[model samples]
Target: MDVTSFWLAGRPATGDETFSVTNPYDGRVVGEVAVPTEAQVEEAVAAADAVRAQAAALPVHVRAEALAHVSRRLAERSEEIARLITAENGKPLLWARAEVNRAVSVFRFAAEEARRWSPTTQRLDTDPGGAGRLAYVSRVPKGPVLGIAPFNFPLNLTAHKVAPAIAVGAPIVVKPAPATPLSALVLGEILAETDLPAGMVSVLPVPNDRAPALVDDPRLPVVSFTGSVPVGWAIRERAPRKHVTLELGGNAAAVVLADADLDWAATRIGLFSNYQAGQSCIAVQRVYVDRGVYEAFVPKLVEAVGSLVTGDPWDGATQVGPLVSTDAAERVESWVNEAVAAGAKVLTGGTRDGAVYAPTVLADVPADAKVLREEVFGPVLVVQPVDGVDEAFAQVNDSSFGLQAGVFTRSLDVAFRAHRELNVGGVIIGDVPSYRADQMPYGGVKDSGVGREGLHSAMSDYTEEKVMVLTGIDL
Candidate 1:
């Protein structure tokens, strides 16, 4: 019976029609959100357009101060925010708290980046013809941005969109995933307390049908989306004129080389592959092990996965919780069943109950199997043995999605080779692909994503560079 309203035009706005926000754990109604009509979506966009210049006109220090204030306020209510994330997204309480912490860091990074925002000055005297001239390359906001985020990691992902826009002084309209809009709405509530201009930030929880209004709108000059490939690409196609940054799905892989520390690889891989029910974009999905250490690594991986506690997300001891919905769990079960039918061996943990799927580990799965090739966005991991590092690298590169790949090797040469040869956005050394620092340049190659999403990278994406030249400058 908790009722949440959309943050629209600097205030809370509600509609007559409302939708139930259910807890994925026990199918209980946790809250209700007002669903906006298409007209309201248009109004929100116009409001954001009206204030784009106001946002851009704000001084850098003021924007930085505002972001810093939000960061401190979020820290004060970290527990409440964590519980909100757990309630809607089905993420474990520990993971939810970590997400909040990362969000706070994101804002802090934005605050720092905002204060340091400046143009690069290039001395034109490098060439004789360029004597007594100076060129300044500076970035400007790309008008209003349309941020479409996914249900997984709702708070941090929304922060990834909003913080950068705030850092660069661009107005942003966030369309959080309908299933988990409460977190974003709460963030909007906090933002309203800041000194930001009216309509600089708006969180609209509308149906998917009305999403086209936000995506295809001509006024919004930039679109930043993080979600599935099909939807992300469709948004790009529809908004062909806008500056689009798509962070899509990935079937991430990791290689365990012959020289790797088997215990280290086994323990890290097991924990990451099943973390948050494997809902993350870069969660370790496919692990390729060198045949020399396959036997020693498999048992340890199986044992690690088997030890995870799966149940209610509210439990402090629970490591794995239910997926976003029962349908998501069923899809994961069916994919595992399909893989098994194609001669795959289930090493351990392949079962589903309601929306809860046990952490599954598979071996010898066919390369064409859906579980191996596609983004099995569930708690499933596939283990394939290879004769050597070359074969393992090939297997990792064989996927259509290449967000990130991890190579565990003590040899510096092998690490360099993997770093150079892997067709992924990032190559992790001595760990799993699930490892991500909040401030790194994070995105994928191929279908994984289109642009980088670290604080600085995202600020760059939300801005456009212009060159200012002085023809008669004395040094």
Candidate 2:
């Protein structure tokens, strides 16, 4: 199956060569997609530009209505989209279906947010009592936006950026990851069916190297990117004028205290720690176990992690699926091996087959290792012993990446201290680091990302503030 031919507008551009989408489970070629060339990207951008004039001219109400129509259509076609996500991205079918639901919710919330957008009113005085003036702040559209979505949560992340831009009357050019472009392409089809008009929302599957051109293009007024930190920074430097919203990589930490319930903590951490094969941005990358419970926690945690069934995501019984690609799988494996070579003990699951690395757990991982310091982007966790809560908090705050962190604790003071000093944007009281809500402010501090994402916050990012002033009024 090939989706490159499914470009939303302009001529269908496919190379003589096709890029294969390999099933990470067995390295089988499940489908082939078109490799878009520079010319194709130009055409797609042109098409989006053609629609930009009309889309920007439309009343905000019209855009909201179009988005509402899209939301309804998406809900109706949720199952089909979910199946495509499963086939293309290799996530569990159940999780894929949940993601589709979340995508639709994002659209719905974005539409509501757009409908409620209004400028703030303020009083301004030009002179004391004699010459008075009134003023207010108005928000204007930021024009066309480019949404570069990653493979992990393709449909939802795309929706988070694209839906709001369209709702607020900005044309969007979406470039989905090559491995998981199917569902996003399907979303484009649904958006096309709405009154969105031609060129308003263009979905193109472009090669990785050619993506910079789309960001560098002067036509785009804003760019919302979700991917690695290096690429995000590169785009920031290259697209100097465009407004940027980046959700970059993170090395999330989860701290388990000495007094915490071992059974409950072990089960919940095991469940959430490996969700989506541990491919999520906020998934726990480092676990700082208090020395009091280190030995006791290791065996139970290892047993829980090892018991997980790693196989096809489509299979209902498969708790852990393959990583996104063989390269990613190998990267995770090599990191674990290096750690073990450096005297880190493998508590359980130090193995890999094709793109499926078993739910791996490591103890005594050094703070400098890539697996502990950087975003692993796989189903692996590193365990380290901390003297106490303060040392654990210090270790968690030691990294440059701080998206979210977690603490399994009973004391309110410890939880509050973790919240105050963990150096992360979010701190979960009794959960792992894999927590996120579409309605809350979501982003990281330091190098993790630039701005916040949730429904309202995203809307704010895509707009500009202009203060309208009035002078020379008789008192």
Candidate 3:
């Protein structure tokens, strides 16, 4: 395979040293990528800082057209990009295709939001003290952004950071996860093709150890991170003065109320629990079914999990594939063993084969097992029986990570109650916690992190409001 160049200030550049990205499935070297030198990283940062004013002053149409161009190009080259995602990230082909499509929509939405950007006017003459005054308020870019992306949805997650920064006129420096940086480099290549300013974007595969200096740099005032709980919080604490947004994963729960369609619930839970090899932050890690339906639901869920096909990711029909590495699979296997030792019974699938762990289910789990209390980050899920809705909601809220939760129910009142009672970023009423639209408001409370994602929401996160008061306005 040819060497993949990192994007430095919208141009491809190679560094002194290179690293190989190997396929997690078979341990074959898929491609080699250049690691950015410290000097190269500094140059990229300085360029972004120097072009901050120019990037912030670009015309809305210029930003919109640039974003639209990227969206169109991604749609045109969907298959090639999807294959690359599967090759390095070990996700199945179908899901890789879905990720590319989601990224396409993300840029499209950013373009629309750029066109719709406008200031709001409010009259400040309600009382005689503020006669003939009007306040015009607009949200402006805070500063240059530092986006740190994770490996699970490498393409789309990076897009979530870069697209919004571009739409809102914020120059951004991206550090893609070292494990899966090829897709992001490809995205940077596409961004380079746009007519936007040169310093608007940079994709650098910086090592994890050297990321703190970027976070602490005052030039980049905003940091957007999506990864594990400890790392996300460490970034925030390290840069307490910067505007930080975290989309950390959680031990997401799926609540199956007694009134839910049991079969549909079982199928969705099974599929999402293991999708993307269960590396997703919102993947279903916990399940709480009403005791009235627990006996009926467990068998169907087991059958659904058993029917899923797992093998090489390049195959078109594979529903599950390897984890990102054998190390990740081993960690998952250890967690499952620990859960079983603590008296949790495996309803199905408690085996590992190299880098792939079988989609496993557990029942009668204690509340404190690592598989139940913490993020398993694997294809393992723990299920428990709840006596009622109150108990189910309580169990879902019990986690320190309150990212998102799924509740299966058909009743309108129960849906409203779930919306009101669940302490999470999003409440999916009829599906699993893994269901996320690229254009909706997303993020979590508590340990799950701060701020929101999606087109308009992320734009707001990258900007702060500025008020201009005109005192000579006539009433």
Candidate 4:
């Protein structure tokens, strides 16, 4: 089989060492990708640093057109890209297709945003001393960006980093997760089709160990990372003087109130908890149910989880697939076993075979169990009954992760209260926490990490404001 080309300075290149990407379900080799050597990495960085000024000075129309071209090409090749995603990452075709569609929208949003992104004028005539003075403020790139993306939702998350950087006219170098580099390599292919500067984009499948040096490099002043909590925080600490944005881990919860549509809540929670093999940062991990409907909701949730088909990712009927590796499955198995030994009752599933762990539901989980307190990045859900709205809200807030939460209530007042009290970044009323719009400010607080994603929000993160004062201007 042919080795996939890594993008260096918007062109295809190869290195001395290469690694194979395999399917998690069958362990079949999906493809091989070249790992960039030290010299190659330096060259990519040098190219981006050398072109920073030109990249930032690019006309808005140029950036918009390049982004639009990528968007159109993504739509045209969506199916092939989805297949590649499944082959390398073990994501089901249904979810993989959704990921590609989201990427399609991200680039389009970036294009639209680039077209109308203009400077704002503030008149400084409010005070007599500042009369006839005008201040024009515009956002400019901090410098070339180092975007480190995770394996789950590889294409869309990479798009989240790349699209925003392009929209703001910032040169970007993307370091895709080693497990699923194919989807991102294909994105570089689409980017190469554009008329943008060669140094504007580079996708390097650099090994995880080598990425820290890239993060610490002085040439790249902006770093945007989306991955595990420990790694994201470490990158931020390593580059304290740089502009860093971290979108880290989450143990998202869904609150079921007495008045919520119990059937709707059960269905959404069951699916989202196991979606993408529960690899997403906001994949439902915790469930706090009102005691009034706790018993009723438990059965419905179990049935919903049991109904999902899990197998080969390529199968259109398969909804849940394997974790990225058998090691991940083993870790989840250990966590589940620990919870069970601590007196947690398995309501539905508590089994694993090879790389795939069954969609699991646990009731009466102890407060101190790792599955409940930490981000369980697997297909496991822990349910605990709360007495009332106060307890429910409190349970949701009793965690280090404040990424997002779902409150399934029809009452406007309760929804408002959830929004006000839930310590998460975004509260979803009548839905699951996995819901995210590509154009909205999406991020978390506390241990979940800082900074926001989404086209417009990320553009702001990648750039800083530069104000020009016009003295003695006639107002």
Candidate 5:
């Protein structure tokens, strides 16, 4: 496949300086693509600005149809996009395919949300004779949104921002992570074929250095970014005037209560925590098992972590793949090593290859260690023993990041306590921390993120509510 350049404003554009997308398994060049310069970023922004009104004016059903078409196209070409994703991102092929399926779900959910946002009405009564007044609510576009998606879950994360923006008649300029832009480019091409107006949406691959020009544009009414905490903070500082939906970093916690079924929780937690090499915002960063089951859970987890097949991402049987780049793998290795040096116990799998780290399990990690505090963004899970549910909640809420958390408990009281005391955005019960439905209200609190990105919730984030009051005695 030729990854040389991409289509911008309905035209193919290439740059002089090219960057190679490497296969992380063996460090081979999968393809080479050109990174857009600041000038090209400006072109994309201008293109989106030019067609904002036309795109926004389309009827709700029309918009829905166009988005549904993209969904269908994505489903039909799922394997191809999955291959591209695995090639560029180094995720297992099965995981990439699953992500493509999730992407389709995002479009479907957004399409449904678009059809539901049509004008609505209500009657209001106030004071004397004011009872004759009428009031109603209507939706208005927030104008062109600048979507900056990260490498992790490239398609779904981008869709979480763009799908909702487009659903609410807002145009978008998407900036995909340079390391994993091919799937987004393919979707951009599919979108261009829809009834969407010219320049309504533009997908441009830009290096990290060029992000400021994309985020700081005044024409962009809202800036939706999904990335690390530092970058999200910087974007907020730079674009203070622009509305932002930042899906930032997270150090998610999973509490395995005493009443929980160790067998069931262990299997599902292993699947979720280790999936995608644990390169997700909701990945299980901290596991707080009760003292009763801590001994039993530790061995079960080590065995489960040992079972993951790590190798070439293209292979269907592969469970874990390399990190997006060698640098990412090395960073994970360093964090794990630092934690071990600081007295953390490595129960199993703390080795690393070029962009590939073994599914590592650490016990008794110090709270101040990078492995416990910062997001590892690799397949590494830290296990700690908690005195009880209260201590579990305390330990979970003791972090600056409050994105999401999970609890495995059969007791309703314990579950409710986790829900109430946990400082994260969503607290899952009987499931791992890595669960996210496309239609649910999804986002973070604190430094994790701001705003939300599900179906209806995201639509609301991309739109403004206007109330129109009419008098019965207007004449």
Candidate 6:
């Protein structure tokens, strides 16, 4: 197997201890990555702090040009990065390619944001209380940012953290998930070629136990983490007083109204629930169908889901691949079995082989069941029937997560109702909650997360606003 080293302070850092990265399909070792020690994590933080000022002082145009370079370089190597993502994260090649494209878009968006960023000017004399003063609110870098990325969407999610920090001129230390560090390390390699300062970025693949060193360190003033809810909240509790943005877990739902087209809704529901093995935060885990159309929609959804091909991720024909590991597949199986024991019927697909779990569709699952209540993070979807749009909306809202929800309705009133009543960061009309534009503000509410994460939104999170007032100045 090939060996990869962590990218630290514009150079590769190798250590004696290493962890193996295996392909979830067939259990073959793809590569090995060196694990950083806690001391190394501290070193990375200090290194980032050393050049924080240089990164913060970089001119906006210079930062924009550098991000543009990174974007161009990424586009050139898209295929290579996509293959790496597939090998490590167990996502199909097609989806991996899409993720690469999204990562490139993220950098481009950040580049554009960097070039166009400007302070908001306010007239301080609105009420004649400050007659001759003008005030302006400017966003400044929040110093060293500790960015922790998850395994799923390894490239784009890391970009969501790293690209914005660079756009806003904040030095960052990224600790990618150990299972999928190669993609982020490859990104770090591309970024190392840019004109960013020496200590501006570091991609360290450290053990989970040692993550606290990076999280609770005093030198890093900002913490942006994308992962499970428990881990994210724990990090927030342990970290010092700093700007923290947590993009945590979600058990997202999609409501199918009686007025909706069942075929269209079923097609979208199947596509998203099985996409990338249903590892997305906003993947349609729970679907609430209006009882009038429940019988028709469920069968169509089962047929649509049954048609998906599950096999080797490298195969172009494969639509769904293995879960991240055999253990994850086992967990999904247990959850399905638990739901089954609790009186839920499997409409189709409740089987597993090695790391591969067939796309599952469950009907009549109780609200209190584990599969219905928790973030499965697998290719299992629960479809529940509701009386009407009101009941469907209520069922969708009955979750600890409020990341995003989808409502399939033709009526503007229903759409507006979902928009107003559904407790989520975003409500999608006529599509699955899985839909997300790379430039849109995306995050969660409640246990889902604490902050938003698009190019502009993340730039805002990585920066702090300061108001400057000139006294006795002509307006």
Lowest lDDT block of 10, candidate 1: 35-44
lDDT of 6 by residue, 283-353 (tens): 98999999999888899999999999888999988999999999999999999999899899998999999
Off by over 4 Å in 2: 1-4, 9-18, 35-37, 50-53, 126-131, 471-475
TM-score of each: 0.98, 0.92, 0.99, 0.99, 0.96, 0.98
All candidates' lDDT scores? 0.91, 0.81, 0.94, 0.94, 0.85, 0.91
lDDT of 2 by residue, 89-202 (tens): 788877788898988888888888878887786666534652477777877677788999999987998888888788777778888898888777778777767776677777
Tens-digit lDDT string for candidate 4 (167-209)? 9989999999999999999999999999889888999999999
User: Candidate 3 — which residues are off by over 4 angstroms?
Assistant: none
lDDT of 3 at 36: 93
Q: Report the lDDT tens digits of candidate 1 across residue range 168-280.
A: 99989999998999899989999999999888888999887788878878889999999999998898888888899999998889899888898889889998998889999
The residue-by-residue lDDT of candidate 5 on 1-475, one tens digit each, is 5656665765557866778777777777887876766677678778878878887788888889988998999999999989988988889999999999999999998898888787786666646656777777888878899889999888888888878877988888888888888778888888878887777787888788877877767889898889989899899988888888889988888899899999887777776777888899998878999999999998898888888898888889999999988888999999999999999999889999788899988987887999998888889989989899779899898888999999999988888878788888898999987899989998889999899989898888888888988888432
What's the distance in Å from true for residue 209, model 2? Answer: 1.3
lDDT score, candidate 2: 0.81
> Per-residue alpha-carbon lDDT of model 3 for 1-475, expressed as tens digits?
6789999999999999999998899999988999999999999999999999999899999999999999999999999999989988999998999999999999999999999988899998898878999999999999999999999999999999999999999999999999999999999999999998888899999899989989988999999999999999999999999999999979999999889999999999999999998999999999999999999999999999989998889899999999999999999999889878989899888999999999999987877889999999999988889999999999999989999999999988988999999999999999999999988999999999999999999999999999999998887
Reference-based lDDT, residue 146, model 1:
92
Give lDDT for model 1: 0.91
Flag regions of model 1 displaced more than 4 Å: none
Span of 10 residues, lowest total lDDT, candidate 2: 3-12
